[model samples]
Target: MMLSVIIKRTFVPGGFPIKYIDEIFKAIDLLNVDSKYVPREGQENLMLDIGEAMQGEAVLMAEAGVGIGKSFAYLIPGLIRSKRLKKPLIVSSSSIQLTEQLVGDIEAVSQILSTNFTYVVGKGRTNYLCYARYKSGNKHKDLTDILTLQEEWKTGFIKPMEKKKWCVDNCLFNQCEYRNSCDFYNMRQNLKPRYTSSVDCIIVNHNLLVEDLKKKVKLHQPGLIQEGHSIVLDEAHKFEDIVRDAFNIKINIKMVKRMERAIKDLEFDLGLNLKTMRLLTEFLEDFNRELIKIYAIEGKYILGNRLDIKELMSMKFKDMNLLLAKFNTMKSELRYLDFKDSKEKVYDELDEMIGTIIDYFESIGPEVSVYWAIYEKIFDVNGLALCSAPKEINKIIYELLFENQKSIILTSATLGGNVPINSAINQNRAYYEYQTQALGLPESTIYSTPQKSPYNYEENTLVYLPSMDIDVREDSMSNDIANEIIQLANIMDGRTLILFTSKKQMESVYGGMLLRKDTFTWKLLKQEDNGSVNRLREEFSSQKAVLLSTGAFWEGINIKGPELSCLIVVKLPYPVPDPVIKYKASTNPLVHEAEMMIKLKQGTGRLIRSEMDLGIIAILDHRIKAKKYILQSLPFRNVTEEISVVKGFVENKMAQYLSEQR
Candidate 1:
């Protein structure tokens, strides 16, 4: 039974009902009346494809290039589907910033389409302030100030309060006196099916979505997100890493100390002579000491091979089993004692935590998971942690998401790998092959041909690869890169962003620039030296200054106009050869280069943010020249190896910019 026949409507070639396509076209026409909206062919095509996928209950992987207006394209279809089906649509993104942006886009789209559907922004439990924790503590001054302002805050999500010790997970849930007024509790209630009929869309970060799936799939519980909902994963390139992190198990000193505290609290409350509890605490202390002996270094180290696991188990397993027996004995005693409900819950939670740790330890092996040990300082307090993460998350992703959801759409600007520019041979599948395999989507998953950005890259951007003969490993590399940056920044008058893969290298180059400060007229700013990333970006936008940064600045940054005319890449962002990378490399030797190409595309994307924007992207590392696939991955068409060409482009663009200002 074809969907078009079942619906008894004329259908488009892509399987979208003709009426739905007409409605989308009408909405776009209405939107185009606004001065800010430009009707893009690619955006319309993407919207139709997404609508077709939703109607067919299929998985879709779309690669929408930057400036293709991807947000509006997906939002139009997502909102229409939710309204038509009378079910909620879930949108998951990788970061808080992007989630917020999507919420704004959804609001704007709903107004234009006149759908008038309700939506809610969903974040993790920790993201919201637990009213019980707020009322229970003498807060730090910084926390106190934020809480004061939270009175007027509608979301109750103070960014600074995230990951703090006294929050939702640490608070009493329904038992708390503040339950009625609790923001976290109320938000949870809003997601229930009874309350969700009016809610057409739910926007959340990837972590919260994964947590919901885990609850539904593993715990036989109603999920935080309602079942049978279609999901749209924006920034889908980052989904794999987020899922891996969500599933990994860790046993840190803090966790053990919390268990000890719970035991002591229970003993006091129950007024029981729990000698075994005392011995359990002592055994935990001994276990920490043993871990410290093995993981003496203050850094991350991979724990490989079954022999290492056997040795650790031999030293600690006997004591752990003895404590487990004692804990079970204590649990039996608890059945006879009339304890408070809260105390009973705490005892059960502690039991589960300990049991999970034991199970995780038993499961440690190279074939199933990757084990690692970390000895680091948290808030100046030294702590040791043993962690285990799955070797691959593809199967889990498929089972939890693709298999269960009615429809799922994974879209990102860099979702696809290198597809040669202007190639016509199965470009759709070839472009998405890496991501489809990496994410474990079905073989029949629909892959949209990559949507091209409307921005004129050939006329507005230049790809500059300096002919400098310097390796990243050389001691003189920082100085040499600094010298090249000085020349380029001088030509652009310091509207430049110098991106580095290494903090040590960035600092060295910053130092070099300081020594030669008089050689250039622009003010120099380094990340963390002046202020936060946002503050530094704001300052750079307001002045002709060069900013040196790494990490977050590599992607999800938008700087338009003359303030950012040049971008300098210190080196290709190759994945650091950690245990995870090593494992991935063992399975696929080309994964490293593939990752580098994706990151290189992201970094270069920071340059031309709009049609009016003109910039030059300079790759200072000579290594990029060897990776021929990079040219195909990047968006720019104008390539040059000479500094003179960069100067010419900068001068012409500057002249054009000044004339436009006049």
Candidate 2:
């Protein structure tokens, strides 16, 4: 089929004007005239696939490999659609960094295409400065500095101000004295469809997008982004987890303390000694005693069979009901009293908190939700929380996002991990099926052929698996991995990123390295030893260093050239068994292995970031040797099980890098 015919059929049948499709083609052709334009076949194919999905108003899942210019692929079609439809195109990503990067990419795309479009980046209420809180006698130095710098700032997103102390938690909305001047309020107002006729695109992180959907569902209000808009989910693999987190409800010790403080403040202001205050105090003491007994082992545990819901209702819900009745009585009393508006707002806030807790407990059941208790030490403070997340978030996602939108496009590089270059059928069909079931996409959802990365990974990258047979579950695995890292670090001249699945393992390996630090010429850095990850990355990037890190470093840290030449995988990135994973495993036994493949792909992708980049990856886990599927999922097939082969490969890459430096 001709490409133009495919474009026409895809868009015209679905109500898009043929002229707009023609314009898109012309704009794409214009790129050839520009000296900076490099024509990539993969990028063009993905762009057309997204365009078809948008015009057809269908759901699409696409996997575009690294360096495929995915942001441009989606943005080209998204911009055209928004312009023609005169409706905002909503683009969501997993991180604030990615969201900001998309904004920059959109600006560049607009310039390349010679099109003008207005867009706004939507963030959570907490990210922006709350004028109401600032004006309410907050004399904190950080707050003052942020306010002083407001003119220089574009979004008023001050990271230095403590969120809990200055965010819009207890906001007064229209009643606030600074509502007209509030940065958060003004930004939200500007995001509304009725007010934002000029805004062609709305960029937001996944959390804010889900929160907007929640607001529409629960509050019956127009969301931060317009409903039924064409949406693109960048880094779409993380969307399911983000939706689960946004919808999960929890009540922690801090919440209980806040309720206590609010009630006491109300009593002092209104001069009314209500019986609800005494009941709340009694409930707090009883709840603490019960938590102390239940949390004998400090971690998350399923609450139903282990700590029977019926028993929980008898102990906590009964008192909660009594407290609810007392609060209801207090609400009636406050209506009759001549209290200030702020005090009345406080009373309503407390009432809602108690009501939400009661509703959460009432809704807890095996079929509808997974209830769990969390007991963990955070920043040296032992905390307890009762939480519940909807077990079938697939249904929630379908109803809230997929069912109502004009079109939905989900795209990522590691969507199913290194789909084969040119298979007649998608070799990763089972993986895509798993994602569809997990995300609740329609049966007819379109799946784009995975666009392979154009980089020369075959010559530039090697996957090294050590022949050692140390079990990762055993205590000795950390030392074994540390020894392997020591050898690889010396071979690569200390340009290594050692990744771990467990923080404890990382610390143990760091300790092992510290003992032999005197022998190495380059600096050895641990993630926690540095004040922050950014600082650690800065030092690692600017000098010859070996970094020991876990978590966020596995992905999203991009360093081209010799600064990050070798990557080490200490273990496969398997998810720890938590309440959520436990429930998922009950339904799909391969959930753990599936998660590890995606993360393993991400970690391996950290090396060979660009075509000029040359590096080697070492997988220290012996378990990967047993799983042939995992090795197949990675980008490069230059595999070796011998340590000597790894040393030789690293030496060649180091030589190439030094030659280029001259």
Q: Best by TM-score, which number?
A: 2
In the range 1-662, model 2's lDDT, one tens digit per residue, is 44653455445358676666666577667754667767676787888888878877888899888888888888888898888888878888886667788888888878888888779877776566566666564555554665664542343233332443566666677777777867777777777777666788888888788998988877877775564478999988898888887877876656766767776766633344334555555554565566556554533332221232335555565566666666666655555555467687777777777665655655564467776655443211125456678888898988778767758999888777532223354454544655777788887688888888878888888888887777766657667777788888888878899998877678788888888887688789887621445547778988888998887788887888888988998888898776687788788666777777778878888887777898889888888887777787777879998878877776665586844531
Q: For every model in order, what is the number of clashing pairs? A: 0, 0
lDDT of 1 by residue, 1-662 (tens): 42333245334354345566667667767877877688777787777678778777788999888899898888887888787767788888887677788878887887787768688777777666666565556454545644664552434333332335445776566677767866777777777767766788888888888988988898978774555567899989888888888887877657766766776776643343345545645654565566556545522222221112335655676676665565556555555655577688777776676566655655464378876544443211235455678877888898888777758899988887773434454768777766776788987798987888889998888989888667866657788888999999998888899999877688889999999999999889888622345656777888888999987789887888888888999888898776676777787555787677778778888988888988889887787688677777787888999999887887776567733421
Quote the positional error of residue 305 for candidate 2 in Å: 20
TM-score of each: 0.85, 0.86
| Cα lDDT, all candidates | 0.73, 0.73
On the 0 to 100 scale, the lDDT of residue 468 in model 2 is 72
The runs of at least 3 residues in candidate 2 whose Cα sits more than 4 Å from the true structure, single-residue gaps closed, are 1-12, 129-144, 147-168, 172-183, 224-228, 268-342, 375-382, 417-429, 529-531, 658-662
Highest lDDT scorer: 1
